[model samples]
Target: MKKRNLFLFYIVVILFFTGCVSLKDVSVYKNEEISEYKYALINSTESLTSNVGTTINGVYVSEGKTVNPRDIISGYLMKRGFIIITEISDDIKDKTLIVNYGESGRRNILFGYTTEVTLQFISAGTKNLVCSSTAEGIGDREADDIKKAITRALEAVFEE
Candidate 1:
């Protein structure tokens, strides 16, 4: 009886710690002109955080560490052949794309974290919207949840 009870306890613990990621409420829109751009500038809004952490100017800082979602978004854009630009200069304005990224609806569940991420693409010169997408992710860790949420959101935007 003691060994059976121990085995059951172990199983419960394993289940509690195991992580899971999911995407939902994904919406995507793309404009035909989006293909004309080759460079991108990413702008991120303030990230929602639980009461336990602090956010500085749209950057999430926890335990003296900073988490910037723009970095993740930049990586995805690079993979899609978009050159990342730090600023908007007249020389490249006509061929540049502006990407707006934000996070919202962050919550901590009983044993995991959930995050919702949104992405939008726009033409820098024309100032017109090109594409947009929204996605949600859930996992045992907050960082992983955010990462997966952004990845899923970008995938939805690019239809990949």
Candidate 2:
């Protein structure tokens, strides 16, 4: 029994180690010029209205309070030497007024709505070149989606 248990343990350990080395080394390389180029995120179109609250996808969301693309891109540029310039559309206010005649001639209903934020990547800057990339998002856009767009835009500029 003891011998059988020891044998099984050894087999399991060997299998685990082998599974870890699935990828083999390759001789692929990137051009030095491309590797050294930098990128940055300068601006985003997201905005926060001074008073009213907003929600995205049914969930309450906050700006200048929650998070924004500019913040993430700025951080990414700091480490990668990339610059991202962002532009946002004018803040739009959506008013939803409801008028209801309640019991005892009482009136119920007021204004209800949320704001929409659209952000565009707009521009990017390198040591010798500047280019524009458009990335726009409406009301409560996903953070990951914005990040992905920013990344793709940066990659495109670097390739050019």
Candidate 3:
């Protein structure tokens, strides 16, 4: 009886761990026709460096309180071979996301820091997709997170 119970426990653990790799959240958007959408990026880089290898300064500005939805949709449509009509409904294909970065650190330690990038995407169209990624480090985690979020968002748009 003990051996059988152990085997059942192992099976449950395997199933739990394996579920993480499945892209179930993205599957809901498979049938949605997303020729284009808006692109608004609110980057909170207080936890990491901004443009590590670039000479630009203060590119990481304060988080904007309000992001124009139309502007983002127009920009996204323009970049992805789609035309943005003024008639586009705010009801459908409305993509808005808030990105934040958080960090915890320990002083006097060799390399002690924890950081994460949180992404929240909301769309009213048939595309019901949401995604996020987090990286912990003292280096370029902010930039990495931005890259990862964008990649995930795009992939979500095209996921089957």
TM-score of each: 0.71, 0.29, 0.29
**What C-alpha lDDT, on a 0 to 100 scale, does residue 123 get in candidate 1?**
89
The number of clashing residue pairs in model 2 is 13
Q: Report residue 21 deviation for candidate 3 (angstroms).
A: 14
- As for lDDT, the candidate ahead, 1 or 3, is 1
Candidate 2, residues 1-160, lDDT tens digits: the string is 9999999999988767544432111111222243333333353336322333588899987553334555654665556554333432223111111111101111111221222122222222212322333332212224433444454444443454
> Largest lDDT belongs to which candidate?
1
Best candidate (score: TM-score): 1
Q: Write the per-residue lDDT of candidate 1 for residues 79-101, one digit (tens) a residue.
A: 98989988999989989989887
Pitting candidate 1 against candidate 3, the one with the higher TM-score is: 1
The weakest ten consecutive residues by lDDT in model 2 span 93-102
Poorest stretch of ten by lDDT in candidate 1: 44-53
Off by over 4 Å in 3: 1-32, 35-77, 84-139
> What's model 3's TM-score?
0.29
Q: Which prediction has more favorable lDDT, 2 or 3?
A: 3
Candidate 3 weakest ten by summed lDDT: 22-31
